[model samples]
Target: MTRYYRVLSSIIVFTMMGIGSFVLSKSFAEDEQNRKGQPIKSREQQESKASNNDLAKFMRGKLDASSQILDGLCTEDFRKIISGASKLQELSAAESWRVSTDVMYRQHSAELRGAVKDLLNAASKKNLDGAALAWTRTTLSCIECHKWVRATLISKG
Candidate 1:
Protein backbone atom coordinates (compact mmCIF):
# COMPACT_ATOMS: atom_id res chain seq x y z
CA MET A 1 0.00 0.00 0.00
CA THR A 2 2.79 2.43 0.83
CA ARG A 3 4.54 1.64 -2.43
CA TYR A 4 1.29 2.06 -4.28
CA TYR A 5 0.75 5.43 -2.61
CA ARG A 6 4.23 6.53 -3.58
CA VAL A 7 3.68 5.56 -7.19
CA LEU A 8 0.30 7.28 -7.22
CA SER A 9 1.82 10.43 -5.76
CA SER A 10 4.57 10.43 -8.33
CA ILE A 11 2.04 10.02 -11.12
CA ILE A 12 0.01 12.91 -9.82
CA VAL A 13 3.05 15.16 -9.52
CA PHE A 14 4.22 14.34 -13.04
CA THR A 15 0.76 14.92 -14.45
CA MET A 16 0.56 18.30 -12.75
CA MET A 17 3.98 19.23 -14.12
CA GLY A 18 2.89 18.28 -17.65
CA ILE A 19 -0.30 20.30 -17.37
CA GLY A 20 1.60 23.28 -15.99
CA SER A 21 4.07 23.06 -18.85
CA PHE A 22 1.28 23.02 -21.42
CA VAL A 23 -0.44 26.01 -19.83
CA LEU A 24 2.82 27.94 -19.61
CA SER A 25 3.62 27.23 -23.24
CA LYS A 26 0.21 28.47 -24.26
CA SER A 27 0.63 31.60 -22.16
CA PHE A 28 4.04 32.30 -23.70
CA ALA A 29 2.61 31.91 -27.19
CA GLU A 30 -0.19 34.34 -26.43
CA ASP A 31 2.26 36.82 -24.95
CA GLU A 32 4.46 36.52 -28.00
CA GLN A 33 1.50 37.21 -30.24
CA ASN A 34 0.56 40.27 -28.22
CA ARG A 35 4.11 41.56 -28.43
CA LYS A 36 4.12 40.98 -32.18
CA GLY A 37 0.93 43.01 -32.55
CA GLN A 38 2.66 45.99 -30.95
CA PRO A 39 4.91 48.19 -33.00
CA ILE A 40 8.38 48.76 -31.61
CA LYS A 41 9.06 52.47 -31.83
CA SER A 42 12.51 52.68 -30.25
CA ARG A 43 15.82 50.92 -29.95
CA GLU A 44 15.14 50.41 -26.26
CA GLN A 45 11.92 48.58 -27.09
CA GLN A 46 13.74 46.28 -29.51
CA GLU A 47 16.45 45.58 -26.97
CA SER A 48 13.81 44.82 -24.35
CA LYS A 49 12.05 42.46 -26.73
CA ALA A 50 15.30 40.64 -27.44
CA SER A 51 15.95 40.29 -23.72
CA ASN A 52 12.46 38.86 -23.25
CA ASN A 53 13.12 36.30 -25.95
CA ASP A 54 16.38 35.30 -24.35
CA LEU A 55 14.65 34.86 -21.03
CA ALA A 56 11.97 32.74 -22.68
CA LYS A 57 14.62 30.53 -24.21
CA PHE A 58 16.32 30.15 -20.87
CA MET A 59 13.01 29.20 -19.27
CA ARG A 60 12.45 26.55 -21.89
CA GLY A 61 15.79 25.05 -20.95
CA LYS A 62 14.68 24.89 -17.35
CA LEU A 63 11.48 23.15 -18.39
CA ASP A 64 13.46 20.67 -20.39
CA ALA A 65 15.64 19.88 -17.40
CA SER A 66 12.52 19.39 -15.31
CA SER A 67 11.07 17.02 -17.88
CA GLN A 68 14.28 15.06 -17.83
CA ILE A 69 14.01 14.76 -14.09
CA LEU A 70 10.42 13.57 -14.38
CA ASP A 71 11.41 10.95 -16.92
CA GLY A 72 14.20 9.79 -14.64
CA LEU A 73 11.84 9.51 -11.71
CA CYS A 74 9.35 7.44 -13.69
CA THR A 75 11.99 5.12 -15.06
CA GLU A 76 13.99 4.73 -11.84
CA ASP A 77 17.04 5.95 -13.65
CA PHE A 78 19.38 7.40 -11.03
CA ARG A 79 21.87 8.68 -13.57
CA LYS A 80 19.21 10.64 -15.39
CA ILE A 81 17.94 12.01 -12.09
CA ILE A 82 21.42 13.14 -11.16
CA SER A 83 22.00 14.68 -14.55
CA GLY A 84 18.75 16.59 -14.47
CA ALA A 85 19.24 17.82 -10.93
CA SER A 86 22.75 18.95 -11.80
CA LYS A 87 21.44 20.88 -14.78
CA LEU A 88 18.76 22.46 -12.67
CA GLN A 89 21.34 23.52 -10.09
CA GLU A 90 23.56 24.99 -12.74
CA LEU A 91 20.66 26.86 -14.32
CA SER A 92 19.56 28.20 -10.96
CA ALA A 93 22.97 29.75 -10.49
CA ALA A 94 22.89 31.40 -13.89
CA GLU A 95 22.03 35.07 -14.26
CA SER A 96 18.95 34.19 -16.27
CA TRP A 97 17.44 32.56 -13.19
CA ARG A 98 17.49 35.82 -11.30
CA VAL A 99 14.38 37.25 -12.90
CA SER A 100 13.56 39.46 -9.93
CA THR A 101 15.56 41.21 -7.25
CA ASP A 102 12.77 41.04 -4.76
CA VAL A 103 13.41 39.36 -1.41
CA MET A 104 10.55 36.94 -1.86
CA TYR A 105 11.88 35.94 -5.23
CA ARG A 106 15.26 35.26 -3.71
CA GLN A 107 13.64 33.17 -1.03
CA HIS A 108 11.79 31.16 -3.65
CA SER A 109 15.00 30.62 -5.56
CA ALA A 110 16.72 29.41 -2.44
CA GLU A 111 13.91 27.00 -1.77
CA LEU A 112 14.19 25.60 -5.25
CA ARG A 113 17.93 25.21 -4.94
CA GLY A 114 17.52 23.41 -1.67
CA ALA A 115 14.96 21.08 -3.15
CA VAL A 116 17.21 20.30 -6.08
CA LYS A 117 20.07 19.60 -3.75
CA ASP A 118 17.86 17.23 -1.86
CA LEU A 119 16.95 15.56 -5.12
CA LEU A 120 20.57 15.11 -6.06
CA ASN A 121 21.38 13.68 -2.70
CA ALA A 122 18.50 11.25 -2.86
CA ALA A 123 19.38 10.15 -6.34
CA SER A 124 22.98 9.63 -5.35
CA LYS A 125 21.78 7.32 -2.60
CA LYS A 126 19.40 5.56 -4.98
CA ASN A 127 16.55 6.29 -2.63
CA LEU A 128 13.52 6.51 -4.84
CA ASP A 129 11.18 7.58 -2.05
CA GLY A 130 13.44 10.40 -0.98
CA ALA A 131 13.95 11.49 -4.54
CA ALA A 132 10.23 11.54 -5.19
CA LEU A 133 9.66 13.64 -2.10
CA ALA A 134 12.34 16.05 -3.17
CA TRP A 135 10.83 16.25 -6.62
CA THR A 136 7.48 17.18 -5.12
CA ARG A 137 9.11 19.94 -3.13
CA THR A 138 10.88 21.17 -6.22
CA THR A 139 7.63 21.28 -8.16
CA LEU A 140 5.86 23.17 -5.40
CA SER A 141 8.66 25.71 -5.24
CA CYS A 142 8.37 26.28 -8.98
CA ILE A 143 4.61 26.71 -8.79
CA GLU A 144 4.85 29.13 -5.89
CA CYS A 145 7.57 31.17 -7.57
CA HIS A 146 5.65 31.32 -10.85
CA LYS A 147 2.53 32.49 -9.02
CA TRP A 148 4.52 35.20 -7.33
CA VAL A 149 6.05 36.29 -10.61
CA ARG A 150 2.68 36.47 -12.38
CA ALA A 151 1.16 38.41 -9.50
CA THR A 152 4.08 40.81 -9.44
CA LEU A 153 3.83 41.38 -13.18
CA ILE A 154 0.10 41.97 -13.03
CA SER A 155 0.50 44.40 -10.17
CA LYS A 156 3.21 46.31 -12.02
CA GLY A 157 1.10 46.44 -15.15
Candidate 2:
Protein backbone atom coordinates (compact mmCIF):
# COMPACT_ATOMS: atom_id res chain seq x y z
CA MET A 1 0.00 0.00 0.00
CA THR A 2 3.06 2.26 0.04
CA ARG A 3 2.84 2.67 -3.73
CA TYR A 4 -0.85 3.50 -3.49
CA TYR A 5 -0.18 6.11 -0.85
CA ARG A 6 2.56 7.65 -2.96
CA VAL A 7 0.27 7.79 -5.99
CA LEU A 8 -2.48 9.42 -3.96
CA SER A 9 -0.05 11.93 -2.52
CA SER A 10 1.23 12.81 -5.98
CA ILE A 11 -2.33 13.34 -7.23
CA ILE A 12 -3.09 15.64 -4.32
CA VAL A 13 0.07 17.63 -4.90
CA PHE A 14 -0.65 17.93 -8.60
CA THR A 15 -4.19 19.08 -7.96
CA MET A 16 -3.03 21.76 -5.56
CA MET A 17 -0.44 22.99 -8.03
CA GLY A 18 -3.03 23.13 -10.80
CA ILE A 19 -5.38 25.10 -8.61
CA GLY A 20 -2.64 27.48 -7.60
CA SER A 21 -1.74 28.11 -11.20
CA PHE A 22 -5.35 28.81 -12.10
CA VAL A 23 -5.73 31.26 -9.24
CA LEU A 24 -2.51 33.02 -10.12
CA SER A 25 -3.46 33.28 -13.81
CA LYS A 26 -6.91 34.56 -13.00
CA SER A 27 -5.49 37.17 -10.65
CA PHE A 28 -3.07 38.36 -13.31
CA ALA A 29 -5.82 38.60 -15.93
CA GLU A 30 -8.03 40.57 -13.57
CA ASP A 31 -5.20 42.91 -12.73
CA GLU A 32 -4.45 43.49 -16.39
CA GLN A 33 -8.13 44.18 -17.07
CA ASN A 34 -8.18 46.62 -14.16
CA ARG A 35 -5.16 48.40 -15.61
CA LYS A 36 -7.10 48.83 -18.83
CA GLY A 37 -9.85 50.66 -16.93
CA GLN A 38 -12.27 47.79 -17.54
CA PRO A 39 -15.00 47.85 -14.96
CA ILE A 40 -15.09 44.67 -12.91
CA LYS A 41 -18.46 42.96 -12.89
CA SER A 42 -20.12 42.94 -9.49
CA ARG A 43 -20.85 39.64 -7.75
CA GLU A 44 -24.48 39.68 -8.80
CA GLN A 45 -23.57 40.60 -12.39
CA GLN A 46 -20.93 37.87 -12.47
CA GLU A 47 -23.46 35.37 -11.20
CA SER A 48 -25.97 36.38 -13.86
CA LYS A 49 -23.28 36.17 -16.50
CA ALA A 50 -22.23 32.71 -15.36
CA SER A 51 -25.82 31.53 -15.23
CA ASN A 52 -26.43 32.66 -18.80
CA ASN A 53 -23.14 31.15 -19.90
CA ASP A 54 -24.00 27.83 -18.29
CA LEU A 55 -27.41 27.76 -19.94
CA ALA A 56 -25.88 28.54 -23.28
CA LYS A 57 -23.31 25.78 -22.79
CA PHE A 58 -26.07 23.34 -21.87
CA MET A 59 -27.99 24.28 -25.01
CA ARG A 60 -24.92 23.92 -27.22
CA GLY A 61 -24.11 20.54 -25.75
CA LYS A 62 -27.68 19.39 -26.29
CA LEU A 63 -27.66 20.56 -29.89
CA ASP A 64 -24.39 18.79 -30.65
CA ALA A 65 -25.61 15.56 -29.07
CA SER A 66 -29.10 15.58 -30.62
CA SER A 67 -28.22 17.18 -33.96
CA GLN A 68 -31.11 19.55 -33.28
CA ILE A 69 -31.77 22.74 -31.44
CA LEU A 70 -32.94 20.98 -28.33
CA ASP A 71 -35.03 22.42 -25.55
CA GLY A 72 -33.07 20.22 -23.13
CA LEU A 73 -34.75 19.95 -19.74
CA CYS A 74 -35.98 17.70 -16.92
CA THR A 75 -37.83 17.90 -13.58
CA GLU A 76 -34.80 18.65 -11.44
CA ASP A 77 -33.95 21.27 -14.02
CA PHE A 78 -37.36 22.86 -13.41
CA ARG A 79 -36.76 22.66 -9.70
CA LYS A 80 -33.62 24.74 -10.22
CA ILE A 81 -35.55 27.14 -12.45
CA ILE A 82 -38.23 27.59 -9.84
CA SER A 83 -35.55 28.08 -7.26
CA GLY A 84 -34.27 30.93 -9.40
CA ALA A 85 -37.85 32.19 -9.50
CA SER A 86 -37.88 32.23 -5.75
CA LYS A 87 -34.65 34.19 -5.85
CA LEU A 88 -36.35 36.68 -8.14
CA GLN A 89 -39.24 36.87 -5.73
CA GLU A 90 -36.86 37.62 -2.91
CA LEU A 91 -35.12 40.21 -5.08
CA SER A 92 -38.49 41.95 -5.52
CA ALA A 93 -38.65 41.13 -9.22
CA ALA A 94 -41.63 38.86 -8.57
CA GLU A 95 -44.20 38.53 -5.83
CA SER A 96 -46.17 35.49 -4.68
CA TRP A 97 -48.00 33.45 -7.32
CA ARG A 98 -51.05 33.91 -5.11
CA VAL A 99 -51.65 37.13 -6.98
CA SER A 100 -52.59 35.33 -10.20
CA THR A 101 -56.33 34.76 -10.58
CA ASP A 102 -55.89 31.98 -13.17
CA VAL A 103 -53.54 29.81 -11.08
CA MET A 104 -51.05 29.39 -13.91
CA TYR A 105 -48.17 28.75 -11.53
CA ARG A 106 -49.89 25.67 -10.06
CA GLN A 107 -50.63 24.36 -13.53
CA HIS A 108 -47.02 24.86 -14.55
CA SER A 109 -45.79 22.99 -11.49
CA ALA A 110 -48.09 20.06 -12.24
CA GLU A 111 -46.99 19.99 -15.86
CA LEU A 112 -43.34 19.81 -14.80
CA ARG A 113 -44.00 16.91 -12.44
CA GLY A 114 -46.01 15.12 -15.09
CA ALA A 115 -43.24 15.62 -17.64
CA VAL A 116 -40.73 14.21 -15.20
CA LYS A 117 -42.83 11.09 -14.80
CA ASP A 118 -43.16 10.78 -18.54
CA LEU A 119 -39.42 11.20 -19.00
CA LEU A 120 -38.72 8.54 -16.43
CA ASN A 121 -40.98 6.13 -18.31
CA ALA A 122 -39.26 6.94 -21.59
CA ALA A 123 -35.87 6.38 -20.09
CA SER A 124 -37.00 2.99 -18.78
CA LYS A 125 -38.10 2.01 -22.27
CA LYS A 126 -34.89 3.39 -23.91
CA ASN A 127 -36.89 5.75 -26.06
CA LEU A 128 -34.74 8.80 -26.89
CA ASP A 129 -37.53 10.75 -28.61
CA GLY A 130 -39.89 10.41 -25.69
CA ALA A 131 -37.14 11.40 -23.28
CA ALA A 132 -36.21 14.46 -25.34
CA LEU A 133 -39.86 15.50 -25.59
CA ALA A 134 -40.25 15.19 -21.88
CA TRP A 135 -37.06 17.14 -21.33
CA THR A 136 -38.44 19.93 -23.50
CA ARG A 137 -41.64 19.84 -21.44
CA THR A 138 -39.64 20.64 -18.32
CA THR A 139 -38.42 23.86 -19.95
CA LEU A 140 -42.00 24.50 -21.00
CA SER A 141 -42.97 24.39 -17.35
CA CYS A 142 -40.54 27.22 -16.66
CA ILE A 143 -42.01 29.20 -19.55
CA GLU A 144 -45.50 28.69 -18.23
CA CYS A 145 -44.50 29.76 -14.75
CA HIS A 146 -42.68 32.80 -16.08
CA LYS A 147 -45.69 33.81 -18.19
CA TRP A 148 -47.93 33.84 -15.16
CA VAL A 149 -45.32 35.47 -13.01
CA ARG A 150 -44.92 38.18 -15.60
CA ALA A 151 -48.65 38.56 -15.95
CA THR A 152 -49.56 38.67 -12.28
CA LEU A 153 -46.53 38.89 -10.02
CA ILE A 154 -46.02 42.61 -9.66
CA SER A 155 -42.86 44.41 -8.67
CA LYS A 156 -42.61 45.66 -5.11
CA GLY A 157 -42.14 49.17 -6.49
Candidate 3:
Protein backbone atom coordinates (compact mmCIF):
# COMPACT_ATOMS: atom_id res chain seq x y z
CA MET A 1 0.00 0.00 0.00
CA THR A 2 2.88 2.40 0.83
CA ARG A 3 4.55 1.74 -2.57
CA TYR A 4 1.24 2.34 -4.42
CA TYR A 5 0.64 5.64 -2.57
CA ARG A 6 4.14 6.89 -3.46
CA VAL A 7 3.64 6.10 -7.14
CA LEU A 8 0.25 7.88 -7.23
CA SER A 9 1.71 11.02 -5.54
CA SER A 10 4.60 11.14 -8.00
CA ILE A 11 2.23 10.84 -10.93
CA ILE A 12 0.07 13.67 -9.62
CA VAL A 13 3.10 15.92 -9.06
CA PHE A 14 4.52 15.28 -12.55
CA THR A 15 1.15 15.88 -14.18
CA MET A 16 0.77 19.22 -12.40
CA MET A 17 4.33 20.25 -13.35
CA GLY A 18 3.66 19.40 -16.96
CA ILE A 19 0.48 21.52 -16.98
CA GLY A 20 2.27 24.44 -15.34
CA SER A 21 5.08 24.31 -17.91
CA PHE A 22 2.61 24.27 -20.76
CA VAL A 23 0.77 27.31 -19.39
CA LEU A 24 3.97 29.25 -18.83
CA SER A 25 5.33 28.43 -22.26
CA LYS A 26 2.15 29.59 -23.96
CA SER A 27 2.25 32.89 -22.03
CA PHE A 28 5.90 33.44 -22.95
CA ALA A 29 5.21 32.77 -26.61
CA GLU A 30 2.45 35.37 -26.64
CA ASP A 31 4.71 37.87 -24.89
CA GLU A 32 7.48 37.19 -27.36
CA GLN A 33 5.13 37.71 -30.30
CA ASN A 34 4.05 41.03 -28.83
CA ARG A 35 7.67 42.11 -28.36
CA LYS A 36 8.36 41.27 -31.99
CA GLY A 37 5.72 43.87 -32.99
CA GLN A 38 3.75 41.49 -35.11
CA PRO A 39 0.52 41.32 -33.15
CA ILE A 40 -2.37 39.95 -35.19
CA LYS A 41 -5.17 42.26 -36.21
CA SER A 42 -8.79 41.36 -36.77
CA ARG A 43 -10.52 42.06 -40.05
CA GLU A 44 -12.35 45.01 -38.49
CA GLN A 45 -9.10 46.51 -37.32
CA GLN A 46 -7.58 46.29 -40.79
CA GLU A 47 -10.67 47.83 -42.36
CA SER A 48 -10.69 50.66 -39.87
CA LYS A 49 -7.06 51.51 -40.62
CA ALA A 50 -7.68 51.39 -44.36
CA SER A 51 -10.68 53.69 -44.14
CA ASN A 52 -8.80 56.16 -41.93
CA ASN A 53 -6.08 56.61 -44.52
CA ASP A 54 -8.53 56.88 -47.40
CA LEU A 55 -10.57 59.54 -45.66
CA ALA A 56 -7.73 61.72 -44.43
CA LYS A 57 -8.04 64.23 -47.26
CA PHE A 58 -11.81 64.38 -46.97
CA MET A 59 -11.47 65.11 -43.27
CA ARG A 60 -8.97 67.89 -43.94
CA GLY A 61 -11.27 69.45 -46.49
CA LYS A 62 -14.11 69.33 -43.99
CA LEU A 63 -11.93 71.07 -41.43
CA ASP A 64 -10.96 73.83 -43.85
CA ALA A 65 -14.53 74.30 -45.04
CA SER A 66 -15.75 74.55 -41.45
CA SER A 67 -13.18 77.21 -40.72
CA GLN A 68 -14.15 79.15 -43.83
CA ILE A 69 -17.80 78.92 -42.87
CA LEU A 70 -17.09 80.31 -39.42
CA ASP A 71 -15.03 83.18 -40.83
CA GLY A 72 -17.68 83.93 -43.40
CA LEU A 73 -20.41 84.00 -40.76
CA CYS A 74 -18.43 86.38 -38.56
CA THR A 75 -17.64 88.71 -41.45
CA GLU A 76 -21.16 88.54 -42.92
CA ASP A 77 -19.62 87.55 -46.25
CA PHE A 78 -22.34 85.72 -48.19
CA ARG A 79 -19.96 84.56 -50.90
CA LYS A 80 -17.61 83.01 -48.38
CA ILE A 81 -20.49 81.26 -46.68
CA ILE A 82 -21.85 79.92 -49.96
CA SER A 83 -18.44 78.80 -51.13
CA GLY A 84 -17.69 76.97 -47.89
CA ALA A 85 -21.06 75.27 -47.72
CA SER A 86 -20.88 74.33 -51.39
CA LYS A 87 -17.46 72.83 -50.85
CA LEU A 88 -18.78 70.78 -47.97
CA GLN A 89 -21.67 69.54 -50.05
CA GLU A 90 -19.37 68.62 -52.91
CA LEU A 91 -17.03 66.74 -50.59
CA SER A 92 -19.92 64.80 -49.14
CA ALA A 93 -20.84 63.54 -52.59
CA ALA A 94 -17.28 62.63 -53.52
CA GLU A 95 -16.40 58.98 -54.25
CA SER A 96 -14.18 58.80 -51.19
CA TRP A 97 -17.21 59.49 -49.02
CA ARG A 98 -18.56 56.07 -49.94
CA VAL A 99 -16.15 54.31 -47.61
CA SER A 100 -19.00 52.64 -45.84
CA THR A 101 -22.59 51.72 -46.66
CA ASP A 102 -23.59 52.09 -43.02
CA VAL A 103 -26.96 53.70 -42.40
CA MET A 104 -25.53 55.92 -39.67
CA TYR A 105 -22.86 57.17 -42.03
CA ARG A 106 -25.47 57.90 -44.68
CA GLN A 107 -27.68 59.71 -42.17
CA HIS A 108 -24.82 61.91 -41.01
CA SER A 109 -23.83 62.67 -44.60
CA ALA A 110 -27.40 63.67 -45.49
CA GLU A 111 -27.68 65.80 -42.37
CA LEU A 112 -24.52 67.66 -43.28
CA ARG A 113 -25.70 68.23 -46.85
CA GLY A 114 -29.06 69.43 -45.62
CA ALA A 115 -27.43 71.81 -43.16
CA VAL A 116 -25.38 73.26 -46.00
CA LYS A 117 -28.50 73.62 -48.09
CA ASP A 118 -30.16 75.47 -45.25
CA LEU A 119 -27.17 77.79 -45.08
CA LEU A 120 -27.41 78.39 -48.82
CA ASN A 121 -31.09 79.24 -48.56
CA ALA A 122 -30.42 81.59 -45.67
CA ALA A 123 -27.69 83.33 -47.62
CA SER A 124 -29.93 83.72 -50.66
CA LYS A 125 -32.70 85.22 -48.53
CA LYS A 126 -30.24 87.34 -46.56
CA ASN A 127 -31.43 85.78 -43.28
CA LEU A 128 -28.55 86.11 -40.89
CA ASP A 129 -30.36 84.38 -38.02
CA GLY A 130 -31.28 81.41 -40.21
CA ALA A 131 -27.73 81.10 -41.41
CA ALA A 132 -26.46 81.12 -37.86
CA LEU A 133 -28.88 78.38 -36.87
CA ALA A 134 -27.95 76.31 -39.89
CA TRP A 135 -24.29 76.72 -39.02
CA THR A 136 -24.95 75.43 -35.53
CA ARG A 137 -26.71 72.38 -36.94
CA THR A 138 -23.87 71.76 -39.31
CA THR A 139 -21.35 71.99 -36.49
CA LEU A 140 -23.33 69.53 -34.41
CA SER A 141 -23.51 67.09 -37.29
CA CYS A 142 -19.74 67.28 -37.69
CA ILE A 143 -19.20 66.68 -34.02
CA GLU A 144 -21.47 63.67 -33.98
CA CYS A 145 -19.83 62.16 -37.02
CA HIS A 146 -16.37 62.72 -35.60
CA LYS A 147 -17.31 61.10 -32.33
CA TRP A 148 -18.72 58.10 -34.12
CA VAL A 149 -15.70 57.80 -36.37
CA ARG A 150 -13.29 57.85 -33.47
CA ALA A 151 -15.26 55.31 -31.49
CA THR A 152 -15.60 52.92 -34.41
CA LEU A 153 -12.33 53.38 -36.29
CA ILE A 154 -9.62 54.71 -34.00
CA SER A 155 -10.48 52.81 -30.85
CA LYS A 156 -8.73 49.45 -30.31
CA GLY A 157 -11.78 47.97 -28.62
Candidate 4:
Protein backbone atom coordinates (compact mmCIF):
# COMPACT_ATOMS: atom_id res chain seq x y z
CA MET A 1 0.00 0.00 0.00
CA THR A 2 2.86 2.44 0.79
CA ARG A 3 4.61 1.74 -2.53
CA TYR A 4 1.38 2.10 -4.45
CA TYR A 5 0.68 5.52 -2.78
CA ARG A 6 4.16 6.77 -3.65
CA VAL A 7 3.74 5.80 -7.32
CA LEU A 8 0.33 7.48 -7.46
CA SER A 9 1.64 10.69 -5.97
CA SER A 10 4.57 10.74 -8.39
CA ILE A 11 2.24 10.25 -11.35
CA ILE A 12 -0.05 13.08 -10.25
CA VAL A 13 2.85 15.46 -9.68
CA PHE A 14 4.39 14.72 -13.10
CA THR A 15 1.03 15.06 -14.81
CA MET A 16 0.42 18.46 -13.22
CA MET A 17 3.88 19.57 -14.26
CA GLY A 18 3.29 18.43 -17.82
CA ILE A 19 0.04 20.35 -17.97
CA GLY A 20 1.60 23.47 -16.49
CA SER A 21 4.49 23.34 -18.96
CA PHE A 22 2.11 22.89 -21.86
CA VAL A 23 0.07 25.93 -20.83
CA LEU A 24 3.23 27.99 -20.30
CA SER A 25 4.58 26.97 -23.68
CA LYS A 26 1.31 27.90 -25.38
CA SER A 27 1.24 31.31 -23.72
CA PHE A 28 4.88 31.94 -24.63
CA ALA A 29 4.20 31.11 -28.27
CA GLU A 30 1.23 33.51 -28.33
CA ASP A 31 3.33 36.27 -26.81
CA GLU A 32 6.03 35.64 -29.40
CA GLN A 33 3.48 35.82 -32.21
CA ASN A 34 2.00 39.07 -30.89
CA ARG A 35 5.44 40.61 -30.58
CA LYS A 36 6.37 39.47 -34.06
CA GLY A 37 3.26 41.07 -35.58
CA GLN A 38 3.38 44.33 -33.61
CA PRO A 39 4.84 47.25 -35.51
CA ILE A 40 8.02 48.65 -33.98
CA LYS A 41 7.80 52.42 -34.29
CA SER A 42 10.49 53.60 -36.68
CA ARG A 43 10.74 57.02 -35.03
CA GLU A 44 11.29 55.57 -31.54
CA GLN A 45 14.97 56.54 -31.50
CA GLN A 46 14.13 60.17 -32.20
CA GLU A 47 11.06 59.96 -29.96
CA SER A 48 13.11 58.68 -26.99
CA LYS A 49 14.38 62.24 -26.50
CA ALA A 50 11.42 62.82 -24.17
CA SER A 51 12.38 59.91 -21.83
CA ASN A 52 9.12 60.12 -19.95
CA ASN A 53 8.34 57.10 -17.75
CA ASP A 54 4.61 57.78 -18.03
CA LEU A 55 4.40 57.09 -21.73
CA ALA A 56 2.31 54.08 -22.71
CA LYS A 57 2.69 52.49 -26.15
CA PHE A 58 -0.56 50.66 -26.82
CA MET A 59 -3.60 52.55 -28.20
CA ARG A 60 -7.20 51.37 -28.24
CA GLY A 61 -10.15 51.50 -30.61
CA LYS A 62 -13.70 52.71 -29.69
CA LEU A 63 -13.00 56.12 -28.15
CA ASP A 64 -15.68 58.81 -28.30
CA ALA A 65 -15.43 60.69 -31.61
CA SER A 66 -14.83 63.99 -29.78
CA SER A 67 -11.60 62.79 -28.11
CA GLN A 68 -8.14 64.04 -29.09
CA ILE A 69 -6.68 63.18 -32.46
CA LEU A 70 -3.71 60.85 -32.81
CA ASP A 71 -0.55 61.67 -34.74
CA GLY A 72 1.61 59.41 -36.95
CA LEU A 73 0.10 55.90 -37.17
CA CYS A 74 -3.68 55.58 -37.30
CA THR A 75 -5.35 54.60 -34.03
CA GLU A 76 -6.51 51.39 -35.72
CA ASP A 77 -2.91 50.23 -35.88
CA PHE A 78 -2.84 49.98 -32.12
CA ARG A 79 -5.83 47.62 -32.14
CA LYS A 80 -3.78 45.03 -34.05
CA ILE A 81 -6.11 45.76 -36.91
CA ILE A 82 -4.75 45.00 -40.37
CA SER A 83 -6.03 45.01 -43.93
CA GLY A 84 -4.67 41.68 -45.08
CA ALA A 85 -6.32 39.72 -47.87
CA SER A 86 -7.90 37.40 -45.31
CA LYS A 87 -9.66 40.29 -43.58
CA LEU A 88 -10.75 41.72 -46.89
CA GLN A 89 -12.26 38.41 -47.85
CA GLU A 90 -13.85 38.01 -44.46
CA LEU A 91 -15.56 41.37 -44.72
CA SER A 92 -16.93 40.83 -48.19
CA ALA A 93 -17.76 37.16 -47.85
CA ALA A 94 -20.72 37.86 -45.58
CA GLU A 95 -24.25 38.42 -46.86
CA SER A 96 -25.27 41.98 -47.64
CA TRP A 97 -28.27 41.88 -45.29
CA ARG A 98 -26.11 40.82 -42.37
CA VAL A 99 -23.75 43.77 -42.66
CA SER A 100 -24.92 47.18 -41.54
CA THR A 101 -24.04 50.51 -43.12
CA ASP A 102 -22.47 51.70 -39.88
CA VAL A 103 -18.97 53.14 -39.94
CA MET A 104 -17.93 50.53 -37.35
CA TYR A 105 -18.29 47.79 -39.91
CA ARG A 106 -14.99 46.21 -40.98
CA GLN A 107 -15.95 46.87 -44.57
CA HIS A 108 -16.13 50.54 -43.75
CA SER A 109 -12.35 50.66 -43.30
CA ALA A 110 -11.79 49.20 -46.75
CA GLU A 111 -14.39 51.58 -48.12
CA LEU A 112 -12.63 54.47 -46.46
CA ARG A 113 -9.42 53.41 -48.17
CA GLY A 114 -11.21 53.28 -51.48
CA ALA A 115 -12.74 56.71 -50.92
CA VAL A 116 -9.32 58.15 -50.12
CA LYS A 117 -7.93 56.60 -53.27
CA ASP A 118 -10.74 58.14 -55.25
CA LEU A 119 -10.21 61.47 -53.53
CA LEU A 120 -6.54 61.42 -54.51
CA ASN A 121 -7.43 60.47 -58.04
CA ALA A 122 -9.58 63.58 -58.21
CA ALA A 123 -7.32 65.89 -56.23
CA SER A 124 -7.29 68.52 -58.94
CA LYS A 125 -11.09 68.35 -59.09
CA LYS A 126 -11.61 67.68 -55.42
CA ASN A 127 -15.11 67.79 -53.99
CA LEU A 128 -14.76 69.46 -50.64
CA ASP A 129 -17.77 67.73 -49.07
CA GLY A 130 -16.67 64.30 -50.23
CA ALA A 131 -13.13 64.87 -49.02
CA ALA A 132 -14.36 66.20 -45.71
CA LEU A 133 -16.74 63.30 -45.16
CA ALA A 134 -14.03 60.77 -46.01
CA TRP A 135 -11.64 62.52 -43.65
CA THR A 136 -14.24 62.37 -40.88
CA ARG A 137 -14.76 58.66 -41.44
CA THR A 138 -11.02 57.98 -41.34
CA THR A 139 -10.65 60.01 -38.19
CA LEU A 140 -13.65 58.29 -36.64
CA SER A 141 -11.92 54.98 -37.09
CA CYS A 142 -9.01 56.39 -35.10
CA ILE A 143 -11.39 57.61 -32.44
CA GLU A 144 -13.12 54.25 -32.23
CA CYS A 145 -9.80 52.46 -31.90
CA HIS A 146 -8.76 54.86 -29.16
CA LYS A 147 -12.00 54.44 -27.23
CA TRP A 148 -11.51 50.73 -26.72
CA VAL A 149 -7.75 50.28 -26.51
CA ARG A 150 -6.48 53.68 -25.38
CA ALA A 151 -6.73 53.04 -21.65
CA THR A 152 -2.97 53.58 -21.42
CA LEU A 153 -3.17 57.27 -22.38
CA ILE A 154 -0.02 58.91 -21.03
CA SER A 155 0.30 62.63 -21.06
CA LYS A 156 2.99 64.86 -19.60
CA GLY A 157 0.75 67.76 -20.47
What is every candidate's alpha-carbon RMSD to the true fold? 21.0, 15.0, 12.8, 17.1
Off by over 4 Å in 1: 1-41
**Top-TM-score structure, candidate number:** 1
TM-score, cand. 2: 0.36
Model 3 lDDT tens row, 50-132: 87777786789988998998898999998888889889888888988875677887888888889989998997787888999
How accurate locally is residue 31 in candidate 4, as Cα lDDT from 0 to 100?
96
The models' CA-based lDDT, in order, is 0.94, 0.57, 0.87, 0.44
Could you tally the backbone clashes for each prediction? 0, 0, 0, 13
Superposed Cα deviation of residue 89, candidate 1 (Å): 0.3
Provide the TM-score for each candidate, comma-separated. Answer: 0.73, 0.36, 0.64, 0.25
lDDT of 2 by residue, 13-87 (tens): 999999999999999998998899847789988897786686556435423432221322333243343333233
Ten contiguous residues minimizing lDDT sum, candidate 3:
148-157
Ranking by TM-score: 1, 3, 2, 4
Most lDDT-accurate candidate: 1
Instruction: Report the C-alpha lDDT of model 1 over 1-157, residue by residue, as the tens digit.
Output: 9999999999999999999999999999989988888864699888988989999899888899999999999999999999999999999999888888999999999999999999999999999999999999999999999999899955896
Candidate 1 vs candidate 2, lDDT winner:
1
